[model samples]
Target: MTISIAETAETIDTPVLPTTETAKPANVKEVLAFLVSQYPLCFAQDEHIKPLKVGIFQDIAQRLGDDSQISKTQLRQALRVYTSSWRYLDATKEGVSRVDIDGQPAEVIDAQQAEHAAKLLAESKQKAAEKRKARMQEQRAKQPVKAPVAPSDKKRPNKTLVKGSKPVKAAPKAVVPAAKETIATVAPALLTLEPAMLAVGNKVLVKLGQTPMPATIQEVSLPDVTVQLGSGMVIKTRQDSLYQA
Candidate 1:
């Protein structure tokens, strides 16, 4: 199957090939190509590729549940390849719409999903670059290394030629730096709170992330509570997400 993923834009498409009536796909690539052919609108190659809906594999599995030719394992693999493709990741940016089985718009991708897709694409590119650099280094290492040439007689006219002298020692090769190591750090946990703090008009700290912001509880519905943040922003969240002010 043809897979041309560009740096600026991803290109993942192949010429549609005829499928076997009885035999299963020989490999995952073949399976993906077949999937593209079956759902041309949902799955595409080159620049036209779009992001599939979340949990799309389950939907596809249910739809093609009766098809004996394509097994569930291969179908899942194909979907993985399609979703992880550079073009697909590129299309999963924020504000892009995901497509359903019939190629209809399912939902607009949110910022979280878009950020995750971008991270995956960056990792993929970094891996590819590392592999390419390794290959180049290997090729360079394989070629014959030339010996250092001796100084010409005219250039060293003041000094006599020594028969047993060794050619000038080649300068030492530059040392390669060690790969960076990731340092893991822990974030402080949220402050504990009592159940009574969930009442209306009670000022509590809402955990937005690592930092908690002060908000006055406006309404209490057991686990769900409505509060007005210190910034004048209103939000609804679970009781567990709040802490004592």
Candidate 2:
């Protein structure tokens, strides 16, 4: 009978493996990249499955310092193993049903569009400044000259106008067109003046006489309401001043 090496190895059964306490870090960047690349990719839908809410993806990328340099596929492989042990890195769908940024869903705004809008606003302001400067210079050029003073007026305390010489024309006052009155047929909303009313609940549409103006109710005072006509402006109005639709 042969003393088999297999029988000896079987007799010396290995002791049970020790329990693991430490866990590996999940490469969140890789996980996000994989999710983004998935088909029918809706930010709201994909975010629901990520361990970290899609909200935290940017923060993680910033911490990583250069997620763009790393290959997404490689990251997915690493995260697959890393998240296997770490549970928080596990994906779920609790927060992915909607697509609104303020809402629960993960929605991304267009940075390029925002940048373009800012550039346009800056250019518009510069043009307006140029127009204002041109108008001021034009007015300065039109001022009238004073006529020669009479010898008799020199003796008097006040500089009296000469009778024979043509009187110096007074500079004409610049007339500004009056602001069109914002009269409306619709009545303003009767919002309760409280802390809750301060919140941007909703914008009220107005039919000011025959003119329709878009304004959001900003501040609610006792008898007056403030309307925001966009462009970071407010128009204070009395309770009986206008109507809302």
Candidate 3:
């Protein structure tokens, strides 16, 4: 096929940049930044790096073409040089470990390093648990243990007058009137009394003379009958106004 003149001209005019190319970081600072951004948890966990494990710093520096500018030994030394500047590498035993980018456990550090770190972590936790147990035991020891009170030793209630305090006299039982005289008194206005008498949270009931009314102790006052009847009717009156069932 004959190539078009416009296509040939366009191809010749446009010199495309090579795609198989890698850019190097400007300096060591840039290399450090890139590494930290890429692998934040490089030196985390028990503050120790494991043997035979790919260190976080080296992997990151190599990926960004910065490793060529520095020697492997030098790079390793720089990474091992722990300082506050490397905030991303803050070691913490409280941190949780999951799979890293390589699908391996994050805390899967050098075997020797991990063994030592694990031992330290276990010792700290053991000390804390022991402290808590000791504190609990101390509290239990300080508590007053009540002996079982025998039924025979229990003091029986006596009906005797005290030297100074007045005796608690029993209330007189309410007299029951004749059945023929007992009758329900009709109310004129159930809501005529003050709402304060039937305040919320108080229990009360409504009665008509000796006859038992369909009522419930929905609310009451200090000396008043403010009741919401079982039939949903609200009434307010004096405690002496309604007779008990």
List the RMSD of every prediction in angstroms.
Answer: 30.1, 34.7, 26.5
For model 2, residues 44-76, the per-residue Cα lDDT tens digits are: 122243233333434334544553444444444
lDDT of 3 by residue, 1-245 (tens): 22222122122222232233344444333334433445455422222422223455555455646436444544453344322121212232233353343435655434554455456545545665687799899999999999998679768675767799987978798998867965557754443324444455444335566544645545456576566666777787676554332
Query: For residue 7, what is the lDDT in candidate 2?
Result: 24
Please, what are the lDDT tens digits per residue for candidate 1 over residues 1-245?
A: 33333332332455335466565777666676677777888877778888888788888888787754678877876676677777788888899899988899998999999999999898888877887899999999999999999987775444565799975655798999997886756656667779966789998899887678999999999779999998899999998888988
Q: Give the candidate order by descending TM-score.
A: 1, 3, 2
Q: Which lDDT values do the candidates have, in the order given?
A: 0.78, 0.43, 0.46
Q: Which is the winner by lDDT between candidate 1 and candidate 3?
A: 1
Clashes of each: 0, 7, 4
Clashing residue pairs in candidate 2 (N, C-alpha, C atoms within 3 angstroms): 48-92, 183-209, 184-209, 186-243, 186-244, 187-243, 187-244
Off by over 4 Å in 1: 1-11, 14-19, 154-245
Q: Is candidate 1 or candidate 2 better by TM-score?
A: 1
Q: After superposition, how far is residue 184 of candidate 3 from its true place, in Å?
A: 99
TM-score of each: 0.55, 0.18, 0.22
Ranking by lDDT: 1, 3, 2
For candidate 1, which ten residues in a row score worst on lDDT?
2-11
